[model samples]
Target: MHPRPPCRSTHTFTIAGSRVAYDRWSGPGRPVLLLHALLFDRTQWWPLAADLAASCTVVAPDLPGHGESPMWTGCTPEQVAGVLARLVESLGLRRAPVVVGHATSAPLATAFADHFAVHGVVTVDEPVDLAGSGPAAVVAASGVDRVPERFRSFAEPREDPGLVAAYRSWLDRPSTLRPVPHARHPADDLNPPRFTPLSDPESLASRIQYLL
Candidate 1:
């Protein structure tokens, strides 16, 4: 069995007058930015983050108006994506992050990739609407997939107004993300091979590795 994955610690950064709070677990390589579903906080990703920490840095941000993060006067996918871009920029990345958005956040992931230099994008449980979001290069993680029974509630596509307002831009916009000429999942899989993330998290984690 593997040792326990690193625990998360909260930190905040100000971007354009808004305070963004995030949970971070230091590791190596490109940081993995974990965006939880609208109804849940960053802690929802704790189990998966721990498993991923050993492989690379894991960062989970509280969606604005949810968890420790306060609501932004204007919550748009581009706005939130900017905040996330700043967060990723703060990581001092050599390459772009593999943005993972869950449920409704999937569109937001595309928004991020649309505006930033992302290694790739991964939508968990939620299929990202690529029409208005993302790099053209898209592929299924051949071996990784799905949700855990308990996480079903969190995976539901439900969120409060603030989240809706923020995500609407992503849903409505036209595709701005540049098509990646080529993209695919990385060969590496989570170690220990037994402990899975939230919804068979290992499978999802393997997909995230595709970009890493």
Candidate 2:
């Protein structure tokens, strides 16, 4: 297991009656805000946070009801986006720092870019469409109460068992946010298609070289 990064000071701000918690890993460059998917807390970004913080100030926040943040009274995606917009404005991030989202957070990232000013946006394994026939279809087909189970059969054991194990552990945790009522099952919110293998380390290294 990787060592946990030292806990940073948390700042709380109110949005629509809910108090949101965020921590900053200060560095001498532009800011980058990291957002995690549903059912995950801010700590899920620890591995990437440390690496990114080496070059830039990194801010990771627990979205409305996730992590230690307060529960959100409203459940629509727009409402969630509003809270994020407020958080960004509160911090006075005027340079339009990069907003990165993972899993279900891809939509939120796009929403951020669409509704707010952001320099760049990155999404990892987020569904392209929330109401599409992808994950939601699987949920409807399986008739399962929880949606995450549908993807279980697709998870292959990688060389690094620890990483795979860690992901599995996260899947087992209960979500802090009030579940979206659109899907009957929890997993239904996830994109049914697996993340592309192009995101693997080897492929990513090659892509980075090309970008350079």
For each candidate in the order shown, give its overall lDDT on alpha carbons.
0.63, 0.51
Off by over 4 Å in 1: 1-4, 127-178, 181-197
Over the stretch 91-178, how does candidate 2's per-residue lDDT look in tens digits?
6646566776566565566666667766666544544333323333322222222323433332221223332232332333322332
- Model 1 lDDT-worst window of ten: 135-144
What's the CA error at residue 22 for candidate 2, in Å? 1.9
C-alpha RMSD for every candidate: 7.6, 11.6
- Residue 87 of model 1, lDDT score: 83
Top of the candidates by TM-score: 1
Which pairs, if any, clash in model 2? 147-187, 148-187
Q: Tens digits of per-residue lDDT for model 1 on 1-212?
A: 12235355779989778888998888888888888765556766776777787778888998788788988887777788998898888877666777777644666777788788887776644433433332211112111124455554433332354454455554454433336422222332222111124546766777777668
